[model samples]
Target: MKKKFLGLLIFITTYASSQTYTTNFNVNTNNKDIKSIVDIWQSYLKTNSKEYWNTAETKDLKNFNILNIEGVINPSLMNWNFSNLILSVNLFSEDSYLIKSIFEGENKSVFAITNVLAKKENGNFKLSNYLFDYTKNWRSHSSENITYFYRPDYILNVEEVSQAEKFYSELCKTFNLKSEKLTYFIAKDCDNIYDILGYEYIFSKGMSKECGYYEIQNNYIFATEKAGANHYHEITHFINKFYPNANYLLLTGVSAYLSGEKAHFGKPLIYHIKRVNEYLEKNKEISLSKPFDFYKLDENTNPQYVIGGLLCDLIIERQGKNGLIEAFKNTKSDEEFLQFLQSKVLKKNENLNDVLRKKIKEISKTDEFPNRLKN
Candidate 1:
């Protein structure tokens, strides 16, 4: 879940005041566990979530209370300023509980819901995530680049670790970052991803039973097997490590460029390009630069991926990674990014949309197998 461009999520018409955020929930407030949780949520509602975590801060357990907001999310990026209200709480056990809530987001039409686990911590209940708890019984093996987490019943073969190590080493060279041990949580499917990330379920971004999500600030990679051991998409996010200034619209494309594949959809970049080409053939006049929501190419495919990926491919092929590092470091605005492209590397790409399709043609002929990995 890159939450890149158009990370817009749900909004219900209902609204609530700060003190009322936890007032209406039907949990047993009299219980110490519930009371502790109520205090946590009330404080969260009263404060702007942005105050809880900074994407650029150096994260550590000692710093977690100040930085890692929760096991799930910092806040909805678009709805960061929106209000949240607790609707209900269900006790899963004396120590574990489920919470449901709505965010009265900036958008008023679409519906969004969020859920988190509340469990006793140090004898005081706090809003929590199941990431570590869910993995308490899981086994792990360390590699040169990755620390793999999965069920003991699962076979994490040697090939997987080798491939993951190769991807990590390549990305380290690509980013010029000193190599550090990576924390990877590999799972059977996206449900494991959601549960590990402090979600019972999430409705705002819509759910995919399979996907890859990167929590870069904490260096956690939640990926399904479909994402593969060499998941350059989410891996790119962690390796980059510089999120505050990341042009995510471009970063999303960069992720596509590096990963060379899509999770869940489980297709390669060229596979998606062929699908988008079919979409373009139907609407010949459609513009990729403009508001192109024709994302319905498939249930899980997003157009930015293929188009952004191609654009990234073009920039890299034309001017190399340093060129991209230039654009990434300096270009902040989307329009600014395009302007940088036009000024620096726009030879055959003057008509960006057509060129993206043309580039796909160029790639399809020789790139059926992602040659980038072979390098």
Candidate 2:
């Protein structure tokens, strides 16, 4: 006879003045091993939960000492493969509550944890309690914020659904530098995205190649991807949206580089270089002479995404991150951004046309357009 076993689980929640988190489980299984594990967890709560809660940090959340957690469980959602547990706790000095809902259903579950930070008393944010609700009423309220982007249709690994929420949480932290209300959607494809965002397709990825698209629309970013959901790269474009004066070359190139480099799109760096180089070779005259013009796509034209992406990396190498960031903030028009870049970084009395032309030549390692004078 084979031993029947359910997956392992641990859900904890902590509350205000307690500095610690507590967890409750709703295990659904006749398996002895699963039941034994569940019993051990319950025993720990009976023995050490109070001790853990007392030692929890009474001060700010960032500095707070959080033990395991304290909360109730929802038994209805519990199954051999799926478990839904809710942990509610009070936080800081405020009377507000923080709710953490941990759902491990199927391969991918949603870890929706909301911390209600209230600074009403002494302007100091206090600890709040936790609650779980499948209805999602407390998400928009309770001083809680959610920045999530999800595409249920595109989800292949159902076991990793929680990853989507986790990725969105990181994006909020990295780009916004703080938590905010966020939600993600699933579109049928790139074309379905157009109805929501009025962007004409400037350039799209090859049909065989899996790629992500990030574009600025009405000073906001609208991203479209075939499968790989890269929120970080798309959010970068959203952040840079404030810089209307930013160069298109910087926009596309930096977005791509960050998508591949910072966000780790799994594509080797050389792959990007080769793609850009191939496109440059095929469209030598258009790319070398005029990058901005080349990016404008028609039935016959190819997008300058790779060229732009490489240029962004070049700028980062030449100018520090701060310099590039400042460039985005300072420039408001294409001409202005290019002029600002040239004046700030290049040789004295450098002609814009010559500077751009030479820059491309140096990077590409070929002067395909030597006959064409830099105007």
Candidate 3:
């Protein structure tokens, strides 16, 4: 009976020591002992089970779910396997630490940076909140005004960054606009983009694969390909901040005009212009008068973008740059923009609808029109 009791006591001691839990350390008294707390958090990350996570604080559980979905489950669904976990911790505040975790995977991997906030209650540190900065894991390169974040495997070249900055400056000068610091996020591929943006939100919106997208709210540009890097098209969207309430048609039109239509595809502007002309020729029933209604047209059949570009070009040519700027500043809707063009930009007696079609036909006949490919 004595030997049995001794053996049971040893087993319990060993098991209790092996189990990891969060450590509470008083900042004023035990500042140097914070490593112990970090160690416990790291151990919990590696060894904790789903049941343990389920019972954890709601904020921590929510963060864990985000990391699991984006970092683990989504990758697994895409045939990637993750391993080789690396965790780095830095003290953020008296009760919080910043944790960065990088995992190596067979197909692809993720690096996650999250702020782990804790509270001391009953002599134990309990997780309170987790605020995540998804881009923290990306490698960053910056100029004076622009910060570009990219994957480790794919990095932006110095020339590309320099050119992007130069173009931004030029756009500011051209538009008489002020410049602001910009952040660019370049994904490895389309799949990786879905990782940056939560899978459900992107897929649910029916967003098709494009080279890049400009997020106006966040002031960030998300790109899937190298061509998407520093494109004037996306930059134009940002510069349009000067005229927040401008007509959508005028807004996109000016961007299309200044940036050119083939900005993403690397073809000359003429390539897209010609494609639009061919589209117009094939479908004569379509009128450029209702350029705003071009959204109703099929994606392949839509000539609105090219039409807008040409119309903007015409406005700049006839009304001058100052006139175009005035229109952008004053026009609030598509109807207002159209009326502005009729009353101010174009000749007073000429019909507004005929001018655009006539210009399209004349430009289509020019040698500058691209004939090799449709798009």
Candidate 4:
């Protein structure tokens, strides 16, 4: 069965590769016409009229491949309010051009750079491709179940990839969730991951060198440097698809608990509980009752993982795993879901916040908390 699956995978990839478009062009970054062309395109974005596009067109407007080029540029540019834009053009050939632009937006204060490919038809340059730079220089690999994109020199091991596939499948079954086709991007390191994702994007900001993230919208997992014992942390986020409205506390805490990575560099859960207890003893200001605003906190300063993990474990102990799953599926919003957890799942007659703090101290006494430092 495995051999047959491998063969089918090979056939699909080969066929897909054969169908991709081929283009011939020389890359020249120092072209004067490129800036003029980009300025016209910017005007088109600002005015939302074909007249600006027509002004930069080398061929009939109808013949320009707008579909192919749109993917390379920011889809949000259609709404305007972009500023501090810098444009660079690379002449792929006498007739083909690749234009790169970097700019910022007011909405999220996001910084983005995009590449647009243009080809000359009948002595006019027509847009051919527009996309993020990460889409370029990527090589694809597949296991029986998952497809991953990686840099040329940073391929993941086939056995490791296969293991991740099996782990994800088993998790779906465990959670009683339907599986989706998973894609992984094995970046050389965390910096490479940031480059693929724009630097100014909120998700890309404040991340440490060891951290990689899963993009829920794109259905892709990015891991830096190492795959690290099945990527169970990110996979947990992917598998908990039922809880679309769950708060970051529940989401990050549950994954941190299950993955065991947040526990003192992947130490046992009790160790993390003890660490949080210790942290709380020194710093009395951090409150578990409030929602964790990740945007305000630095990447490494998250207490949510430790406190949240212990809370999740408590929920499982008192209410059972199905009870936790029920809370996830039924909750309408972040606030409502957290209230449900306190009222329904925790079910303590006393103040739940005080109860959780006491529970953390109690759990710190467990044998799982190591005596000698593992590090």
Candidate 5:
């Protein structure tokens, strides 16, 4: 944790150049294991193939687990957006290693660091993930709907555990889908979760340090919140599974609609709507077309979630559950989505942005936003 790559100097001049591609593989001497490590890594850098990504992991696991865990997939040093890459290898044993990659940004000292574990294999080496090794010592608790994993030293929130089980059943019943046991992992803070999963320090584009990801197919959640099964925002992510054929982005809106910042994190979706409205008022030119702003004015909030939730609110308000399901299952393209929104919410002459701003402002005035799931 706290960026463990020590004594690895990054020369900033290379990052200042244009589209310059190279690999700085640093190793002390020529040993068989080190040779294999260099060979496998250089091969990966050259072809950027899936073969390398797959075999680089431990015997029974794939490196893609890290992809699902961290949400950062770097296949090669060939990214056009970054200036240069620095790769350092630290061998824990002849059979184990931790590979750290520091991607230097062109603009400033800002760089993104990612990690992978290299294990010696058949006189060579393969890249593995840090997750399984990290979680081996952790404790677990099983309920009717969740299998919870946590650090041994952590105090289990039994109340939240019960709430999580209750919420899971409620959500399943509301969506008319069978409830499945979710594999939920908890950490004290997000940064701790990152550390256990091979992330050191991630610069949040100079914003808040909030970051986390979940494995949808596996129904695995790696979160920092003690809310566990009671995690409303994340539990609502199951809507995608219920409507597998639905637009995923819209399903995310559904999740944001149900929980957003409330249910455990305090503020409601209306809280975000208010802050975003203030942001819209000051920016003046912010349009509905650009509704997915990553730099959303509120803490850990963005426009896509806010706008889309508002759209969900309007759809359900006008059309109810069946109509909302229709939009979820049928609305595929952005064109279709906009037209659907236009038909449902737009007044005679108002543009999509105009209507969206009005709804956002109206919702902001209320202390609480309507959650259809609660019905």
Candidate 6:
């Protein structure tokens, strides 16, 4: 009985210690190299600990259904005394998916790591973490390729350059943006853009991805790829950068209004318009309600852009151009944006029910409302 109890105690201790990974592997490659890598990971885990998993930026990192990190190393060839050694790191995540790199270190060196995602007790793969180099060059990650110039005044290459330019020009005018300072780019990889700008407005490449906030930076937008005029949606996101933490409810409606983009699923025009009119009538009184879950519908719901745009237009009509701009420029969290709107825009006795009804009646009273739909 004494022997069995001692054995059980030893087993429990081992299990508890194994719950956290504290092992380190020093490669024979180079002392400086290995130490550098370790430093980066150590610093990152310290600042971005499991606690940050709940923050808006890396909430997904806390998914917790992942495997242990597998391998990490340097991939970039360019190096100086210490710069080149740090940039190479490749990490693999859940399902053995390769998540390339994360920059860490004193100089913010880039590392590419490979991870093998762990499975739950049920035997399905999930993400672990990354593995990469620390023993080499750290500055190799800071190249023009990794830099994004955010001058919203610049031009971008897309399908309709002229139309896009015109659209941006008008939007800048409406929002008091200095168009000469706007810089833009067209890139295929959102991850790359995220690294450069610390934020991105990605139009996804496939299904299974819907429009939502992506952590490429703490708050960036990624839209559905199939959008006909994706730039409009993305630029609206660009405009929204001015209002970080503004509620998606207000942001969505306001952006759609500013960019003249509409909500679209796979649906016909007239059918979509009718659905919009119905949704507008049903939720007209719920100012926050209409904009909050506008994108939460399923396949049966067609292009909601028309209605979404209209809703934003109604806001502009009520608030005026400067009001919209002030909403964007306002410094507040997601909750504060809503609170301000409640106190200022939707003050007591200013019944949105009557306001919306009158607004809708006035909007629908003219052919201009439908004419705006001719995108």
Q: How many residue pairs clash in each candidate?
A: 1, 47, 0, 7, 5, 45
Question: For candidate 3, lDDT tens digit of each residue in 1-375?
Answer: 011111212221111112222322332224543454455445556654332232344433333433333212223221222232324445666755544333333322232223344445455554433313346677888797788888777857788678778878877877767788787878766556555653322221232334455555445666666554666667777766678657656666665566644442344445566666676678887766766654433333235556666767777778877777778787787678888887888786886567877777777677563221111
Model 2, span 245-270: residue lDDT tens: 66655665555454433331334333
**Candidate 3 stretches greater than 4 Å from native:** 1-133, 204-209, 260-268, 296-302, 365-375
Residues 1-375, candidate 6: write the lDDT tens digits: 011111212321111111121222323325443333444433334343443121322353323212111100111111111111222223332323222223222343322222222212233222233211111121211121111222233333244444545665665665555643322333233343322322111111122222322221222223222332234544445455556644444454444444433433323223444555566577644452333334423444422344444445554556865565566566245466555666657757665445544555565544434323223
lDDT for 210 (candidate 1): 54
lDDT of 4 by residue, 1-375 (tens): 011111112221111111111111442324556645665555544555554433443243332323211112223334334553435456666666655554454332434554556555456554543323445677787766567787777646776676678767876776777887777777666656555643323223334446555555445676665654256666667855567765556666677666644332334567556766787777677566653431123333345566567656666676777766765666656577667867876655666567778887887887653211011
* Candidate 3 residue pairs that clash: none
- lDDT of each structure? 0.60, 0.38, 0.54, 0.53, 0.62, 0.36
RMSD, each candidate, Å?
4.8, 20.1, 17.3, 12.9, 6.3, 15.8
Ranking by TM-score: 1, 5, 4, 3, 6, 2
The estimated TM-scores of all candidates read 0.78, 0.42, 0.60, 0.65, 0.76, 0.45
**Candidate 6 minimal-lDDT segment of 10 residues:** 69-78
Compose the digit string of candidate 5's lDDT tens values, residues 1-375.
Answer: 001111122232333454333445565336665556656655655454555543544233433545333222222224324543436667766568766665565654645566667776564566666776778798999888789888898877888888778777877887788887687878666677766766665543223244344565667676665444456777777667556546545675777787645422344677777778888888887777534332345454556667778777777877887778888877676567777767765567867677778888887888888876576
Point out where model 5 deviates above 4 Å. Answer: 1-25, 44-63, 68-86, 104-110, 121-124, 178-181, 205-211, 226-229, 241-249, 260-266, 280-295, 298-300, 344-351
Tell me how far the alpha carbon of residue 13 in candidate 5 is from the true structure, in angstroms, after superposition. 16
How far residue 358's Cα lies from its native spot in candidate 1, in Å, is: 1.9
User: How many residue pairs clash in model 5?
Assistant: 5
Question: What is the Cα-based TM-score of model 6?
Answer: 0.45
**10 residues in a row with least lDDT, candidate 5:** 1-10
Better of 3 and 6 by TM-score: 3
Which of the numbered candidates is closest to the native, going by highest TM-score? 1
